[model samples]
Target: MPKLKVKKSAKKRYKLIGEKKFIRRKAFKGHLLEKKSPKQKRNLGNKVVVSYSDTKAIRKMLIC
Candidate 1:
């Protein structure tokens, strides 16, 4: 069989944690930060696990 290539976009977006779980950056912090509160910006800076509903699809993209 041919080598399974990983999706470049997924590689840049998601990070593999352990076995199956993946972590990603929170959204809405990309721009227009002036109106956002400190607390909101702080929370958005942290990485969050991908939603359970999307786990399977992410794994496939990662070729895990």
Candidate 2:
């Protein structure tokens, strides 16, 4: 059987922290920054953990 490779794109998009937790970037920070509030922009810059439901699938893609 062929070895399953971890997806490089998924590796870049999500980071494994501690053990089971995956840290990810917040969306909506790409364009039209002027229209968003300062607070909103600040909040979007933080890294957050993926939801419990998504962690299982993401783990497979990441080969964790």
Candidate 3:
């Protein structure tokens, strides 16, 4: 049988921590920042954990 390879796109976007948890960058930080409030833009700079419902699926893709 062929070895299962982790998805390359997923590998680049998400990171595995310890065993079960994954960390990902927050959304909406990529564009249109000029009109957004400073606080909102600032908050987008932080990383956020993937939600609980998505955790299992993301872990499979991340392979960490």
Candidate 4:
């Protein structure tokens, strides 16, 4: 059987912590920073865990 290849894009973005947990960066941190308040920008800088519903799919793509 052929090896199952992980998605390169997901591998670069999401990271696996252990068996099930995955870490991801918060959205809105990439653009429009000029209009966002300082507090909002600060909050966006924080990394967040992926939601339970989305974790499974992300894990599959990020398998490494």
Candidate 5:
């Protein structure tokens, strides 16, 4: 059987913290930062765990 290929994009964007648990950068921090409050900007900088609803698809792509 052929080896299963992982999604390169997913590999780059998401990180494995543990089995079945993935972390990713939060959105809305890349642009328009000047208009957003400092608190909001600070909060956006942290990595967040993937939601349970979407975890399966991401795990499939990541081959976890």
Candidate 6:
């Protein structure tokens, strides 16, 4: 059988942690930051775990 190729886009955007958990950056921080509150900007800078609904698809892109 041929080896499966990992999705480059997913590889850059999502990170694999341990087994099935994936971490990703929050959006809305890339632009228009001047108007956003400092609290909001600080919160957006953090990495968040991928939602359960999206975990399966992300796993396929990353490992399948």
lDDT of each: 0.93, 0.94, 0.84, 0.85, 0.91, 0.92
TM-score for each model: 0.87, 0.92, 0.85, 0.85, 0.87, 0.87
Q: Write the per-residue lDDT of candidate 3 for residues 1-64, one digit (tens) a residue.
A: 9878898998888887766678899989999999999999999999887777888898777554
RMSD of each: 1.3, 0.9, 1.3, 1.4, 1.2, 1.4
Predicted candidate 3: what Cα RMSD to the true structure? 1.3
Best by lDDT: 2
- Winner by lDDT between candidate 5 and candidate 3: 5
Q: lDDT per residue, candidate 1, 1-64, as tens digits?
A: 9999999999999998987788999999999999999999999999999988999998898888
User: Model 3, stretches more than 4 Å misplaced?
Assistant: none
lDDT of 6 by residue, 1-64 (tens): 9999999999999988887788999999999999999999999999999988999999888784
lDDT for model 4 comes to 0.85
Candidate 5 lDDT over 6-41, as tens digits, reads 999999999888777789999999998999999999
Task: Provide the lDDT at 8 for model 6.
Answer: 95
The collision pairs in model 5 are none
Off-target runs (Cα >4 Å) in candidate 5 are none
Deviation in Å, model 3, residue 33 alpha carbon: 0.8
lDDT of 6 at 35: 98
lDDT of 6 at 18: 80
TM-score (C-alpha) between model 3 and the true structure: 0.85
Q: Residue-wise lDDT of candidate 2 within 1-64, one digit each (tens)?
A: 9999999999999998898899999999999999999999999999999999999999999887
Q: Give candidate 5's root-mean-square deviation (CA, Å).
A: 1.2
Better of 2 and 5 by lDDT: 2
Pick the winner on TM-score between candidates 5 and 6: 6
* Candidate 5 global CA lDDT score: 0.91
